[model samples]
Target chain A: MKSFLQPEQWTMAAASHWLLVTTVLLSVMACSSVPAPVAELAAAEQAILTAEQARVNTYAASELAQARQKLQDARAAVVQKDMLQASRLAQQSKLDAELALARAGAAEALAVNDEMKKSTEILQQEMLRNQTGVKP
Target chain B: MNYLKRSAPTAVAAAMSLMLLGACASKPATPEGVINARQQLNKLQASADLAVLAPVAIRQADAAVQEAEKPTKDQALSDHLVFIADRKVNIAWAQAQDKHAQDQRKLLTDARDAARLDSRTREADLARSDASVARNDAERARDEAVAARTAAEQERMAAEQARSGAEQDRLAAEQARNAAALSQQEAESANAKAAALQAQIAALNAKTTERGLVVTLGDVLFDTAQSNLKASSSSHLANLAAFLKSYPERGVIIEGHSDSVGDEDYNFGLSQRRADSVQGYLLGQGIAASRITTAGKGESLPVAGNDNASGRQQNRRGEVIITDAVTASN
Candidate 1:
């Protein structure tokens, strides 16, 4: 029993090793086989990320500039003895800066989710090829 | 598994926080609402300023209201002042009219008093004139009475003078009648004396003429011897008577003679008786008695003287007187 059990253990160990090896190999092959498309996909993703970051930066800059201009108008109204108009302009500039900050955060989160979906589709194609013993 | 669990919880928490933040940020602040809030604040500030200046603002509003109401009050005051002025002028005019009426009454009273004085003076003058006329009438009546008395006196004097003249005329007529009576007596005496003288002459002639016997009786007839009528003488006387009868118409007067004797009265008595005897003898001879008147002459009327006896005888002789003559033819 021990002998039999030892042979089975050895076969299992071998199969397990084979499976590990095949999986590794298939992963390597698959990796190697789609390497240019992956590289193009990564470049497209980087370009989308960069365009989103620049849009967020532009929004942030416009909001900060409006805030700065509102503060300057407030100071000028106070000097001209128009305190009521100055306070109204200062409150409107604060609200525009907070809306620009929220739009930048939502654009960064949508780019990260697009990268995860590409990874999961590649894993599912490899498993099907192994089962059908067909060349994907 | 630990990483998945931790990351999933964290991601859910993060998603919830983002949604809440987005909702909070999405509501936009409007500029119109800010402007409305500012206007409300400005109005509140002005209300506060008005409260601080209340005393000055209220005084200014009151002054404006007083100025707007002034013209209406001024118009009413002017109308009342004009009414008072008109009343004062009317009172002055009425007083002047009353003064004029009083002056006219005084003038009329003065005129009436003067007229009464004039009438009294005229009546006094008339009374004086009437008194003067009555005095004049009394004087004229006195003058007429004096004239009547003078005329009566003159008439009485004239009557007295006429009576005296009538008495004087009666006395002169009585004296003339007495003188005529005396002249008639003297003529009668003269006639008697003439007859005696004629008888004496006649007796002497008879003795001469008759021639009878001469009886001488001369001596005897004387009274010496008593010659009275003797008886012889009677015869002689008778003879003489007879002679006288022859002459009848002749009246004879007788005479006697006487001688110187003792007394002349005795002698004259003897001569007177001789004459008487002769007359008686002649009467006896029938002679008419109315033819003869006898008277005695006495001795005073004797023609002869008485001294001698002859002369005495001559004176004593008787004589015859013829007193009347008769015509022989008748």
Candidate 2:
């Protein structure tokens, strides 16, 4: 809170202002060159939410956990201002979440197929028995 | 040289940036994950078994693969899309498998039902055929039994007829045998009578000659060519008469023969007188006149040669012959 209006303090303020402006300009240029991964992060979050909604915890628990970890990594990359790495991690998270959702869907389909197969087998055996005049 | 030295770091930084941008621009020709997703989608589309059953799933997988294969600046985004697409393809494949299995099971069930129905139909047909065969067999057996019974009845009737015929034949044969025996008895009785007659005739020294039963009175009985028979000859004539009377059906012939001792006419007259004398003696013994015949053989019918006295005496004879019934009737 000391007065910076003295001649020596004024020279120090001028050098500091020049350095701060250069740093701001460089930061602005870097921000313009590398955009934020806002869309990818949102997509990853939506995918993870969808995986959870689809009961991936039961069918693809490991994949869902990996997706959540990847999503956390993407957020850390965003905090570190690593736009490219953030984008990559968000994408990886989205992919993992999608994979988890797909695995859940596949598991559900496989379970249904197994049940159908069992029913079909029983039906076939019963039909065979009937045809052969054997007791069912 | 100083300018070169001053621009070296910038040049290197520019080159590195260029290389980085080049790497970013020149992406992998095809992402393996996306390619794999595309291949799985293609396979799902190609499946005909699941076309109708999982049409929606196949369409979704195809859409997801197309999305995944899209060129993007973010490789991770591409990978993520590819992963989702691959999973979608897997989901589509799973759905297709499930539906395909269900359809196969349905088809098997239908076939099994049809087979059961066919088996039942065949069994029913066999049963009907067996029933028809049984009926035919029963009918045939009944017919055979009826035919057998009829044959047995006919045989029994034939046997009865044969028995009656045999009985009749036996009675007829017995009657014939009885008649034969009666005839044989009659013949034996006749033979016995004939034998008795022959015995009586033998007592008179009678002999069976070609003419008939002949009782000869030698020249001794005629008394030296006299026409009259001697007393010894009367016994022979008496026996002949008695035989002739017993056999009324018989007749008698009185034959006289002489030796060649005189003229032929005188010998013939002597023979006739001797035959008439024998016939008169038989008539006196109660033999009917009709039952007697007389003949005279002159010296031509001499019984012996006239070379000596004994031969001439033997030739002079009076014979009484009993004729058969046939000759008598004639």
Clashes within 3 Å, all models in order: 13, 0
- Local error of candidate 2 at residue B127 (angstroms): 14
Q: Over the stretch A2-114, how does candidate 1's per-residue lDDT look in tens digits?
A: 22123433455345533443453345445454211222222222222333344656534564455446545644543444444444444433333333343344434334343
Off by over 4 Å in 1: A1-136, B1-102, B105-107, B163-226, B230-257, B260-315, B318-330
Assess each prediction's global lDDT (C-alpha) against the native: 0.46, 0.75
Please give the TM-score that candidate 2 achieves against the real structure. Answer: 0.37
What fraction of the true interface does each of the listed models get right, in terms of native contacts kept?
A: 0.00, 0.13
Error at B255, model 1, angstroms: 12
Q: Where's the lowest-lDDT run of ten residues in candidate 1 chain A? A: A35-44
- Residue pairs in clash, model 2: none
Write model 1 residue lDDT over B65-159, tens digit each, in one string: 23322233244232222222222222222222233334444554455445444444444555566678778888888888888878877777777
DockQ of each: 0.00, 0.08
When summed lDDT is taken over every stretch of 10 residues in candidate 2 chain A, the lowest stretch is A1-10
Q: What's the true lDDT of residue A44 in model 2?
A: 76
User: What is the TM-score of chain A, computed separately for every candidate?
Assistant: 0.42, 0.67
